[model samples]
Target: MDNHFVPKLTRRALLISTPFVLAGCTTASRETVVTKPIVPAEYLAMYDAVDGEPYPVDAADLTRVDPAFLRREVAYNTPEPTGTIVVDTQARYLYLVGENGMALRYGIGVGKAGLEFSGEALVQYKRQWPRWTPTQDMIAREPERYGPLASGMEPGPLNPLGPRALYLFKNGVDTLYRIHGTTEDWTIGKAVSSGCIRLLNQDIIDLYRRVPPKTRVIVLQGPASGYGV
Candidate 1:
């Protein structure tokens, strides 16, 4: 046993070993993209093959889909760090930012005119097959529609929140809005929800699995074609 013959890491050795790290910084300082992440064709194809629904999705229901509502990946240059969820309320598009100026885009249904919610929030919690309950305001607006469900509706394939729900919070309080799933895929790319942000059930389920609690979400107004830098 040679107790005193320990390996040494010299400054020159460290510098030589990490030249690529410093080169990356230099490349970034130049403000030109040297490399970018690309979503593979096979990876993109998986979204179309989502199956094993709790109950079969109506074949007729799936056939009427508008092409614009399909999930996609796009070049999204933003100052926001990777993993931030940016919602363009006016555009009816939600972007999940990722590395090297790329994003996963989802078509969504937003709050109807007066019910729009805007600003920054954090994903406080999430659920699978979440329960549904109309807010008091909803009950007041349409007692006949929501009065019976105020206590909370049980989780099911038909729940308005659908297969997944990402509860948002601002300043440690519930925002009363969710980035949630809905079975009504046709509603996507339309502004027709009561007040919540809605996505296709399959899409939300995919998103829920990707984003964790504490992720920052920015809800923005205006028709910004892509995220801002």
Candidate 2:
């Protein structure tokens, strides 16, 4: 008797099995899959707030709130007691008066009372990350302070006004004082500006979007009712 035994096999079975082995080898040699990086949802939300535009790295950097930070507690909702802004230079507060004698109060940084004005004005123009040009008087008063930029300071984080600015006008002439954002949040409730009203960057950004061009603005020397916070 022969020690070896022969087994029958189909040609088709051998052909089908050969290709599967080859397929395994081919698949192993193929490139790995790659995916594009996705931006975070918080960043997307911030982008949407700014008209869905990506932050301009070269233009200016605005102070951004940390998405994780807890918002400050307010006794009332913002856009509070909505009326109009009444800047009281004497009290160092801007009141947003609401109905029924209710008011939303916000601390403000005001200019020296002597240098400030009181009257009705309107928002004639607005700018984003506006340029800072020191007036001739500003240069003369503090040459060392502004000597670095004889021409003017271009838009940037360091600029006195952080991000947005609203130009106030009376009749048809510019008042030369602006309601704008400030890098110095600590200055709120104090007199530190040169006849301009300053708000925190975040606060001003919120206000800028709400107010339209030609909105009535009144600067009052004394406190007034119907102010909005």
Candidate 3:
């Protein structure tokens, strides 16, 4: 059956197949089947807390999140070494390779248009409850929107960067992109970010604690290019 035609996935369905099918993905390491871990209480609490000053607690709506976007396990047929991170942007999913042909998959929000990242990088560092600093380009495009943030916004639930950030680096240089948490849980499974990949604040907090610095990250453009470990 066509991936597009695939029906809505249950938690169980995700373990069996992927809606965004991987065709001709490059396999480099060992085989592993991916699966989901249990959602923790602390991860869920951040969404309920009123972190941002004016943003209502209600704005951190978890109801809008697609069930499939939640973290879960799935059958990942990849060659990338166990513990590598493979991001299928086109599919809006991130995978952490595991042993014995398995992986832990999470639904994700990708960057808009030309902002999608493709290639090998490393998680050089991580920050908890990070501040938000809008880039100069963001300020130039909409000074009214980002000019005040030139000095950086304090970390909070309202901050677009959410609860944690995993900085991505390439060849010893910053990629200016990150895998971070967002208050906008609804954005998962969509392409609506400046240039960073966003996850539910709860989810990022979960992944942040799991992924270590220097972890290999492989971002595939689309299925046509195949995936790596």
- List ranges where model 3 is wrong by over 4 Å: 1-60, 224-229
lDDT of 2 by residue, 65-171 (tens): 22211112112222322445556677665544434444444446788757686798877877888887876766787899877776988887678766788888998
TM-scores vs. true structure, each candidate = 0.74, 0.60, 0.73
Better of 1 and 3 by TM-score: 1
Give the residue spans of candidate 1 off by over 4 A: 1-62, 223-229
Q: Model 2 off-target regions past 4 Å?
A: 1-83, 96-104, 224-229
lDDT tens digits, residue span 4-57, model 3: 221222455333322322234335677564443433343344345544433333
**Residue 7 CA error for candidate 3 (Å)?**
30
RMSD to native, candidate 1: 15.5
Q: Pick out the ten consecutive residues of candidate 2 with the lowest summed lDDT.
A: 13-22
Better of 2 and 3 by TM-score: 3
* Each candidate: RMSD: 15.5, 25.7, 14.2
Give the C-alpha lDDT of model 2.
Answer: 0.57
Each model's lDDT: 0.73, 0.57, 0.73
Q: Residue 34 deviation, candidate 3, in Å?
A: 36
Sequence-dependent TM-score of model 1: 0.74
For residue 149, model 3's alpha carbon misses the true position, in angstroms, by 0.5
